[model samples]
Target: MRAYIVPMARSLTVALAQYVPLNGPDEVEVLRSSAAEMCSAAPGLDLIVFPEIHLCGDGDDAPDTNEWLNAAAEPLAGPRQRALCRVAADLGVWLIPGSVPELGDDGRVYNTAIVVDRRGDLVAYYRKVFPWRPHETWAPGHDFTVFDIPGIGRGGLSICYDAWFPESTRSLAWMGAEFVVNVVKTTGSDRAQERILARANAITNQVFMLSVNAAGPVGAGGSLVSDPEGTVIADLPSDEPGLAIVEIDLDDVTRVRQHGTEGLNRMWSQMLPGDPLIDLPVYSGHIDPATWRPRGQS
Candidate 1:
């Protein structure tokens, strides 16, 4: 089946490096406006993925994430999520609200990526596995999740720092994911860094990797879309607020899983001795956002 995603980029365009500190009410309001813009860019969008915590700004200079996100965070069946889900269902497409601060069991929250299908039903949810710095304040996600977007093979889920881990991406691939969507709010990382990830993830798993980052101070807005063979087909400027829509063939996804003609063999599946990380268990609550399991290839 033919496939595509309208990677809606909004707010601090692609000009801000690292992270953009929320300047004022106007800057904070950009989050809500982004959703409206994504809806307008909706015509042929089969799936739309937004940036990580695109709803809330950074900590030091932005609005209170708890207040701002909680205000906007839909309670499983709340308004914000419902409105976006409505857009997906009405458009006969899939919607992935990259990341949000979801309320948890205790006085805690989860950095989560919530998914909705064409029917407006919440299919799967992925909590950020590798919580960023301040993320220590939030709840840790326990498992990796993959969701089928109707005709799409299987789509994987991860948030910002989680992109740093190969297991997070590969787990999705092993679970039958042909497309992996990595939602990021990277403020200080360079385009080169993100490029390495997209290309590596795609090349290793032989799957399409969509790296969508919030353009601002924190995420260093270098959003990218890579093919299964690990070739970067499209890249957005680090400081521009823009939307990138790409049409990708999923069949190519199968080839990348088991590298054939490509020069680069799968990176994560191979291992070596003396690599410090010797059979580490999944960290329960203190997992670092950039820590991947030593067994990405094992």
Candidate 2:
């Protein structure tokens, strides 16, 4: 069984992550320090997940997402990621830092989820393929990304807003990802939308999903770890800061997948009016010759 530890995030109930930093200097310090502390909190687990934008108070003055994206962004190998890497190395666990704005070499910003292994090696970088509204300030990621994690099956990654679109998750499933991580920051409205993604993707792809979200502003605090059958094994307390621990066994996923909808999942066909839903795949027969985005974003 793969034991996963998810943070019970404390985010703003109605404000953005940036505003929560205004939540007192000590509070900001604790939020920024959460990942490193996990090294000691639960060292026995194989993996640990934290919410996106864990660094809340960087003294950024930008009023817009872009401005904040640029200002609060971290330099590669900066203190932030390095701190988490050290924890993974010391504890012999893989760590998924939900994600943060990264200032790339060319100075363009990108929303990135970096995966670090037990030895603390940076294995994969899952850039946000779709940056949501106000995110136009940062560059949209050009391609889908995935990689393997020992004992965790072929894991996948998706950042906030990316969950609303089916293409990325399908692309990962198509590429053989067995487990997917949806790490995000959300408010009340967005949280409901994300839950739909978790439930649907599990049924369609036969893959497990583990979500890490913030509690107050950046997220609704509904961190979850679900199976391929779309059954949530464990979850963090909603509207509060707490931890959710789940043991993910590869065999369990294999067994449930083999049984199909009769196994651990809720029948997706039952998704009715206003249900958080995943739509049937749409295959575009032809591109709009006028202004279709080139298949290769380049």
Candidate 3:
């Protein structure tokens, strides 16, 4: 008899920079410096993620969101965004500068999040779809976005309020996303509920979840990371700037989905080819048996 050995783990090192946003003309400088310092301290950091709208801070305090947007918003091609992309390239690390106030060519502002790869290329940008209503005035986005990390895994991007909608995570998972990063800046009392939703989203989707919230004056903090089994692997305190450095094994997502969450409940596997097409009237769609499982599994 011969012993067998499995291959190496596909792990990803992520740093959740839950810091207070420096909302000013030099905010981009502050971001560059902070990211450089983080890369220096933690060498080989695969990804660095910030909170939602960190560039603009908590501008909702103004008479109207547009008032703050007029002063802080920048076009996608502006120097500030380009500078942030350079930081990722220079540091040789993936970076998500959180959500920024994007001055669209249509003369409307959008709460947008951009992804910069290790090569500093602006790969993907997601405009927030489900903006916090009545409070958020920015134009809502129409589509969801996901990106790949080469040998690591695929990742999806969603903003603070998007987590409130289950369809967001489910659709991303269906698109072959191994993990979803929900950048957040929650200053309200609903953070408690948001935490639960994070774990629930991970468990139901069988994907890793990183909810990175801001801290100090702009947010209530309490950032967290949930694994494929719905276990909160890392978390930060409330109302304070902190960093949550988490290393996740993408293999765990495959393991849980294959072997079941606790070796018992395999939600995706529950739907078989012979099952009927379940109709969802709310979205005016139906769950096709041909595409019911995870992207590749189907």
Off by over 4 Å in 3: 1-7, 58-61
**Order of candidate numbers by lDDT, starting with the best:** 3, 1, 2
Q: Which regions of candidate 2 fall more than 4 Å away from where they truly are?
A: 1-43, 57-62, 263-298
lDDT string, candidate 3, 1-298, tens digits: 5333435778999999999876666787888889889899898899999998887754656677667776677899998788988889988999999988888889888899999999999999999999898877889989999999999889999999999999999989988899999999898889999999999999999999999998977788989999999999999957789988889999888888877888778888877768899999998999887787877653
Q: Which candidate is the best by lDDT?
A: 3
Best by TM-score: 3
Write one digit per residue (lDDT tens) for candidate 2, span 91-140. 67677756777888778888888888879788988778888765356677
lDDT of each: 0.63, 0.63, 0.88
* Residue pairs in collision within model 3: none
Q: Hey, what RMSD does candidate 3 come out at? A: 2.4
Selected candidate, larger lDDT, 1 vs 3? 3
For each candidate in turn, the TM-score is: 0.72, 0.73, 0.94
For model 1, the stretches where C-alpha displacement exceeds 4 angstroms are 1-42, 58-74, 134-136, 258-298
